[model samples]
Target: MIISTKLTAERLEEIKNHPTSYDENSPKLTKAQIARLRPAHEAYWNVTPVKKTISIKIDADILAALQSGGKGYQTKINSILRKAITTGDY
Candidate 1:
């Protein structure tokens, strides 16, 4: 990610004129914050790889049910399956 921080003299003057627009001493993250974040970060990295797709068939009623919601039916199906796997409900 590329971050650009260019502060012109005019911009600095505007900030000084409106200091209240910004939050001061926003809560700092500590070691406890790092500990709390580790599990979710690790879980994200532990995801299994998706295999390549192949031709398949399903009941016409089920296909219609998925397609009735609107566009991107295939993506929606994948999202449903992913949520089920994540929640151990599949």
Candidate 2:
């Protein structure tokens, strides 16, 4: 099971006090470096949510169209659903 944690100000301060070895090598990025960054096609969540496998039925035509778009189609669908929920567009 995946566990998610929120970084509250108090928790962040606690983490700041005890630096990990990995943190030592990673310096803060400059504006130029930050600007140069590009997003990954998918799998960009900092802490990936737990995914549950379930069977979902879709219309043949709709399913074919999504599949034809190629790999990451399911991720695309999830994006669509998330947007719909946020905007109440569905």
**Index of the highest-TM-score prediction:** 2
Would you give me the overall lDDT of model 2? 0.76
Which ranges of candidate 2 are over 4 A from the true structure?
Answer: 1-47
Clashes of each: 0, 0
Residue 12 shift from truth in candidate 2, angstroms: 40
In model 1, the clashing pairs are none
Model number with the top lDDT: 2
TM-score of each: 0.44, 0.45
lDDT against true structure, model 1: 0.74
Per-residue CA lDDT of candidate 2, range 50-74, in tens? 8888899999998899999999999
lDDT of each: 0.74, 0.76
> Model 1: per-residue lDDT, tens digit, 1-90?
853467978767776797443345665565556445546467678877776787788899999999999999998978887877655465
lDDT of 2 at 21: 55
